[model samples]
Target: MTKKGDQRQAEELDPRKQTILKAVVDDYVETAEPVGSESLLQRYPLGVKPATVRNEMATISDMGYLHQPHTSAGRAPTHRGYRYYVDRLAEPMNEDEARQIARRLAKTVESQPEMVTATLRMLSGITRYAAVATTARDQSLKLLKCVVTPLTRGRALMMCAFDNGSVDSHVVDLGSALSAQQMRRLNASIAKLVEGQQAAEVVALKLSLPVVEDRFLQDAIARTLRAAQSSARVATRGELYYEGILKMMEHVEFQRSLESLEQVLGALQDKHRVYDAMEQTPENELSVMVGEENPVPELQNCSMVVARYKAGKREGGVIGVVGPARMRYSETLPLVQQMARSLSGVLAKLIEE
Candidate 1:
């Protein structure tokens, strides 16, 4: 069925059934156990007797929203049930929590790598799930500046700064030291050759100079050019940051089966697959995929809350939280939204400044 048809069918569920499903999902998320009518009556204000609630639960199960794991066990939500519950969640983020998220994000170091690391740490710490983000490589990123610093007797470090607020560095072995005048002349030569070139162009670009009599200057220029090419290649590829994998393993879902855990870990290890999954969500919007809704086979048993954040006016990237299908959607949604907002704001400011 189409998404609209699926939504309409979910909406057609009676009000009482919706309430019971919400309660069961909430309780299951909290305790990771099957919920029965007796437990619902004690914890939630369901205005019905035991017989009525049990009958309703049975009917909902028949419709495939809830599943009975064992013949004697109570009902837990199926993937369909989680989908319905997530679609209907209406809770808004708390004002205090929003302020806290903003405050923490503002304190992140104003560099690309540091900002990504701090954002991942805060996300995993708040959600207690694995947090992953990928920064898209901009082919048109211009090489704004390049600095070459002489290190030991035979080594030098070359740092290249890009227009997108990212810096790539390389260390090269220089055959001989360059004099002050030669260094100045070499810097000028490099700036003229490659400073305004795009990262994609620089990857295949060759740095050349008019004939210079000094062999030391010739060798130094050659080494720096090769290092610049390496740095350009680094700049042209996307960057992936992932954290909290070990922490995610502490959840009971993964502990249930060694094979399941291995499968999930293996899937996440593939950067291309993870990037493809994130690509399904549109830019500047938050998306939730629960259980079977996930496209990746290993992730089908899991849930993901993903959001795309703007890095600059024309640049964007994806950030996400991954956990078991029984994740607390009500809380995860707002947290992911806030993190995306903060990340976009910080990145925009960094790019501008």
Candidate 2:
């Protein structure tokens, strides 16, 4: 149904109806079993008797918030029911849980990549679902050093070093011979231009041929700098890291989504596709996209609980858990949020050191 229709229906529900709907969603999430009126009255302290509870469950099912799989079976939450619970009924996860998540992430890792891997590993273990981490699209590419070597007449090799410990080199055809002193000067000037700036910022930079007296020297430096900037931007494809695919497979819903599982795994392995999934929802806010609500067809049977984390300084990235739609939202939602914040802190600390 449309957003307007969903809202209108929500508004029409009285307090009693809303309370029953919340109870049904919460119970179904916990047990992954259908909730009958008898179960509701038995579990909750609602003063209503069994008949009234049954009537309300029937009404909610009729209103598209709940579904009954069989004639004698109990009713379970539909996608709309889950949506309503997330938007209105779900309570914030507590302070103690948040503290535990933070402490777990504070442990040291060897490098930025390891920190990312560890983040997903910890999150998957905590949530019992497939956890994924996508690095920030933009990272400040800090230049560390530049070297120019004479390969042959009218040609030289330029090697640029970045703070990330990766080196890139390309050959520049000077169109004329260059001296060792001139090569040193070219390297120094290039470093001075981009040492502290971001990759994007320096890529658009215009260099001066008049910076040096010799035309061959100036031309060589310009070509080399362009090569370095291009290389940096090309390396900006964010890395995709995932864990606990098997853990999630332990659930029944994913098992039923068997044919779609291969497609989902393929998408996970492709960072661009993972980034697309991350961008499907807005940044910073935690979201629960259930069943048909998922943008990807392969994930239509699955539910994704995603949140964003800071990559370090200016830009941020995304992380989250993907599990069956029957996932316990009350348990999973806050954990994902806390883990994202912890990941941001870890990456920031890594950047500082």
Clashes (N, CA, C under 3 Å) per candidate: 0, 0
Residue pairs that clash (backbone atoms under 3 angstroms), model 2? none
Which residue segments of model 1 deviate by more than 4 Å? 1-11, 139-237
Clash-forming residue pairs, model 1: none
How much lDDT does each candidate structure score? 0.81, 0.75
RMSD of each: 12.1, 10.1
Q: Write the residue-wise lDDT of candidate 2 on 263-304 in tens digits.
A: 666655666555667755566678667766776666766778
lDDT tens per residue, model 1, 213-293: 888887777778778877776676677789897766878888888888899889889876777677567766788888877
Q: 306, model 2: CA deviation in Å?
A: 1.4
Error of 1 at 204 (Å): 23
Q: How much lDDT does candidate 2 score?
A: 0.75
TM-score of each: 0.70, 0.68
